[model samples]
Target: MKYKVFVAGSGGIGEAAALLLREWCEFETEIFLGDVSEENLAKAKNFILQNSQKTSVVETILMSKDGTNEAMKSAFESCACLLDCSPGTQAPRMARFACDFKMHYANLTEYVAETDEVIALAKDAETGFVLQTGLAPGFINVLAMSLYRKFVEQFENETIEKVGMKVGALTAHAHQPHFYGFTWSPIGVATEYVKPSRVVRDYEIRQIPALSDRETIIIGGRTYEADLTSGGAADLPDYFRHKAK
Candidate 1:
């Protein structure tokens, strides 16, 4: 059976995800790439077609800046799942469409306010709603929890001294003055730098300013600076509150 998947946003992440779904998904998939820019939509469609399998179908829908386009709504209503790779600020709107369309909703936004709104909206939703499902908050959080569980089982200890997690999407070469290139959204990077981070310290969940505590570390013979960032903690601080530091 062919499942229709709607991807709202034709940016880098959305294009890559749509291509992956078209090529590697378990079942046959018909993907619709929606974006406010026709150029981006065309580019995304071409990229997907170049990399997709013959059995998969790729379509495009021209979305409005406000996300109120009737064509976009029709596309959403026809899909089985809505993968939102748009900006964090737009997460709530995309999630609302998902809930109303009764489609599984997943988003890659780490904006706490928008995520909270989606959580409230999806609390009673029959369809599944996944939020902040990107690199840091998504995979790293799960990896940390798994390692924590293994540590407890292996050492027969209920608590540990400290749990620290760091992730970076850096380019091969670094220049001076913020030695980072734009691998992801620059707005997202700015948000991480400015927002307050939630972390467990001294066996308690505490809020601290991002980039407050910077440390130098060497990985694979390369040195890099690391610091606290928001939206990467996931639910660890909440789960580990009063459990471990």
Candidate 2:
């Protein structure tokens, strides 16, 4: 059986996901790439088709900011899942659509407020809702939790001292003034910088301003600067509050 999947953005992440699903998903899938921009949707469709290695079908839809487009609604009604790769600000809207359509939902947004809204909306949903599924909050959080679990098992200890999680996606070389190149959404980067970070400090969860604590570190014999950023903690601040400091 071929599953229908809806992708809610045609930008970098969304396009990449569509391509990946087309090429790598175990089950056959039909991907519908939706974006506010027809130009982007066309480009993404071309890219996916050119690079696809499977026989999955790829389609496109024009999604409005409010997500009330009749065409988009028709597409949503057929899909079994919606992968939200749109801006973090749009997560709640996409999640609502998922709920209304009775489809499973997954999102890559690290926006805390929008994520919370989705969580509340999906709490009683029959389908599943996955959020904060990008590298920092998703992968790093899982990796840290696994390591902590292994550490506890290895030492035969029920609790630990401190747990620190950090992640950075950087270019080969960064110049002065932002020290960053635009590999992903600049707006998302700005949002992370301005939002407060949630972390477990002294065995309790606390909110601190982004970049409030800066430190110098050496990785692979290269010295670099690091600081606190928002949304990367995932649920660790709550999960490990009593177990780690």
Candidate 3:
């Protein structure tokens, strides 16, 4: 169905998502881009307008941090879905708006506490509320489950030694002090590094401190260091507690 989408953040991810929706969506789409920064909103609007193959009605709204303004209310009430590309810290706020407006909510945040807050806010909501729909926690987790299901069907065995899921966000070049460079949100990297990780150990669900377990591994004839990080495993550790080691 043709519908309106409200993009909560106008930063890198938000802008890209808006552009993709306009360019790739088969159905006609009306997009409302909202952000606290006017410059970001302008840039995002220009990028989508210039790059999209299909013509769409794109509007930009200057949203308050708390989303209490009249413009925010009008946009929230109008859209069918709220695609939250804001920072992890703004997850619950965005989810709350979606729930109140009876709109579908989706976000790409790995912050554990914020995710939990969204869960609580959306537990009784009628509309769909999807959280952590990002690369590491979202796509990687789904891929692991798909592989596990395939393994059980092919081998006729649910028991497995281990299902290791690893993902790394790296830059082409590095600098002094910290070797990693950010192509995305730096807050996400910091939060995942400090927060506790949800993992399955000894066929039981456990919360282990992030980065506590570190090891060296070789992949594609290259050496790299890996560690436990928060939210990367998603809920696989819980769903496969006894089924996988």
Candidate 4:
């Protein structure tokens, strides 16, 4: 059965997921390559052609924010799964679009509240809504669930004393201007870094600063620093805390 998949972002994340979907699934996958410009759509298309065979690629709608909502409506009505690879703040509208269209939703937003909404969507729906399915959120969620399941299987009743996670993405030959970004989103990065966070302090929810959790460290040959970031805590605590019984 050729399941139809629709993708709504054409930047690094969207394009990458679409390409991988093309590689892995025997489904009819189409990407609505919406960007704020035509060049971006062209670039995404070109990149897709380079990585994937030029078949009837589901369909590519080169619409943007200023672009019409007509195509968005059509796409929402069509695809079985809507995968979002847009900006961190753009998750709600995209996810809402999928929900209104009666389609399954997935995305790579590292924001906790956004992910919470996605999870809430799954409560009454039959479609799959896999939130935070990328590097930190996706893989991290899988691993955490695995460990949670393992512990539950092993001991059944006890409080989980602690959970600590460390994950990051870096580019080679790191530069200071963008530090670790090719296409930098300074505001978004700053917002995340400066966002006040909630952490399990002595087994109780406590507010802490994300970047304030920073520490300098020595690596293989150089020293670097990283602040604690919340990638999976929004929903995991609820899952783990409940299962710790």
lDDT of 1 by residue, 46-156 (tens): 988887656567889998887477887788778999999998999888988888889999988877777879899999888998877888888888888899999999999
Quote model 2's TM-score: 0.95
Q: Which regions in candidate 2 have their CA more than 4 angstroms from the true location? A: 173-177
lDDT of 3 by residue, 1-245 (tens): 68999998999899999998887888888999999999999999999988887777999999987647999999888999999999888888888889899999999888888888998998899999888788888999889889989999999999888888889967789987778887678788888899999988788888989999998999899999999999888767778899777
Q: How far out, in Å, is residue 92 in model 2?
A: 0.7
- The residue-level lDDT of candidate 1 at 205 comes to 83
Candidate 1 TM-score to native = 0.93
User: Which lDDT tens digits does candidate 2 get at residues 184-210?
Assistant: 688998988899998887888899999
- Candidate lDDT (C-alpha), each: 0.87, 0.88, 0.89, 0.67
Tell me the deviation in Å of residue 95 in model 2.
0.5
Question: Model 4, residue 188: displacement in angstroms?
Answer: 4.3
Best by lDDT: 3
Q: Model 4: residues >4 Å from true position, as ranges?
A: 54-58, 64-68, 120-126, 155-157, 181-188, 215-226, 241-245
Worst 10 residues of 4 by lDDT: 236-245
Clashes of each: 0, 0, 0, 0
Q: Report RMSD for candidate 3.
A: 1.5
By summed lDDT, which 10 consecutive residues of candidate 3 come out lowest?
A: 231-240
lDDT of 4 by residue, 177-213 (tens): 7666544345546656777665666555666878777
